[model samples]
Target chain A: MESFFTDSPLDHETLRRSVEDDAAGAVLVFDGTVRNHSEGHTGIVALEYEVKLPMADKLVARILEEVRTEIPVLKIAVGHRMGRVSLREPTVIIAVSAAHRDEAYRASRKIIDRIKHEAPIWKREIFADGTSEWSLGCTACK
Target chain B: MPKLVRVEIRYYAQLREDLRLSNEEIELELPATEEDILNRLAQLHPKQAALFLASRAAVEDEYLPRGTVVQDLRAVDVIPPVSGG
Candidate 1:
């Protein structure tokens, strides 16, 4: 039951261990990273993401509810970052703990997909030329 | 004169900064449809109108089908397609 907005880099080891608690039989973690090329652009420097906290939280809650009903998730953790993130850096992390491996895997995948499609967050790409452009595939804001 | 119906307007992402507005409380004449509001918005702010024309919309958090009526006003979130890394 963890949901937070963070600017710090992701701690993968901490997340993996945290999800492997006493009651959990299996834990699955998925990481999303910033890419170098997007929307036919080159010379990409970094990306900055932002979200409307209240609305984003609501959307996340809905996704969590779905995960609870559809999967055997005992605990779930989701963290996303804002501000500047360098290439190859993690932007989103989700951990799912369940009694079985399948549920954990499915829940993590579902949650990540839903977050990408529904969250109100936006990312801006900074180019080496000191200009920026918005990333594509953002169906939520549209 | 027809009764005035209040519809709340909101913009997010680049469109918000482009419009120079976040949200506004206003009353539109009753029987006003979504297009009516869109037309008025275009008249009020052409740049935002272009943005809206290029984007999609959601009413009360749910994406509405094309040409839905705006009788109740409620809450409208004008969303533009945003990208993530």
Candidate 2:
């Protein structure tokens, strides 16, 4: 298992390789990238990700452990990017390996979903208009 | 004399933007609670009061109950709703 929060751009290939195993027949990967539009806003410039580093690191580890226990996966690796991510740039990646395709796919799905909702990372959308807004991930803040 | 305690407050996302502050240090009355600290922050930044009231507080990396005494708090992170993918 591996988890990281870095200001550097994410490398999906590196994450996939980290979870590669000889016994595993399937290696599934999920990449969350910055898109060009959100809601009704178009011509998006980039996404800014800010995190409470210590809490985020701890939560990512917890999520990885929980997912591993629930799924019979051989290996798992997850990485999230901090700082600014331009359009089409990846913000997060989750890779998992298992003896079969089903386990790998399911584990990868669960990891990403949990990380999005449970982690203390936040994202802001920067539009081409030079305006930005925080994405609503938690109800209390909205 | 009543002692004063120092608490560090860290902001994130929209709260940070609204207050134009990433963090701040405040001296509070001794034996203050998390709510007291938040209320104090709201007073200092009235424009962000609603956000403060809606946010959650974590002290020393642990989620703090509203009524928990904060005399020993070294820092508090005010977390807005998280939106990550």
Candidate 3:
């Protein structure tokens, strides 16, 4: 799938091969994982992701389209995991295939950045201290 | 005719917890803006007024611009700032 949201664990190898094509010479992948700390806070236990459903799905497709229009890439795929994700587990994966490494890299970065900024998904960081906080979207923290 | 309408309101994240709801149906009059809805919600849930007013709203599938009329709104989602990866 070029874009999707799931509750199951993300498989990096599967995502990389999703964009595999004979016409492409290079494939780039970006994996986002749950970290153990954030903003100087420690003991972070897990992350809970929630998506707005059809809207988030539509947004992902729109982002991919926008990126493809701007870059000459052979294929691209992006996926995000919802529900509870454990520490150090991959929460998102983006893969892009192009004739060259530079375009693949650029497309990979753009897809993830746009998904983070445009997708209507929310994440709550659950701490080991039994507290949780919602991450501020890209715009608000700035 | 009295300009009356009903719009579904969806809450997310902190706003959901603060309001203790995930979604609700609200009755409002015509010419009501998103701000009006937030204000009314704040009136009903005073403890979460600040959070309510701080949220952004979307009508149908598009973000409702400030001062946009809510006359034809079938649903409006009260979205707190999104945090996704």
The residue pairs found clashing in candidate 3 are none
* Prediction-by-prediction clash tally: 1, 0, 0
For model 3, residues A45-75, the per-residue Cα lDDT tens digits are 8999989878788778888898899999999
Q: Of the pair 1 and 2, which is ahead by DockQ?
A: 2
lDDT of 1 by residue, B42-84 (tens): 6678766766765555665655566766556566776666453
DockQ of each: 0.44, 0.63, 0.66
Per-model interface RMSD values are 2.7, 1.8, 1.4
Chain A fold similarity by TM-score, each prediction: 0.88, 0.93, 0.94
Better of 1 and 2 by TM-score: 2
**Residue A49 lDDT (model 2):** 92
- Against the correct fold, how does model 3 do in TM-score? 0.87
Off by over 4 Å in 3: A140-142, B32-46, B65-70
> What range of 10 consecutive residues in model 1 chain A has the weakest lDDT sum?
A133-142
Candidate 3 chain A, poorest ten consecutive residues by summed lDDT: A133-142
For every model shown, what is its TM-score relative to the native structure?
Answer: 0.78, 0.81, 0.87
lDDT of each: 0.74, 0.83, 0.84
Error of 2 at A77 (Å): 0.9
For all candidates listed, what's the TM-score of chain B alone? 0.73, 0.84, 0.83
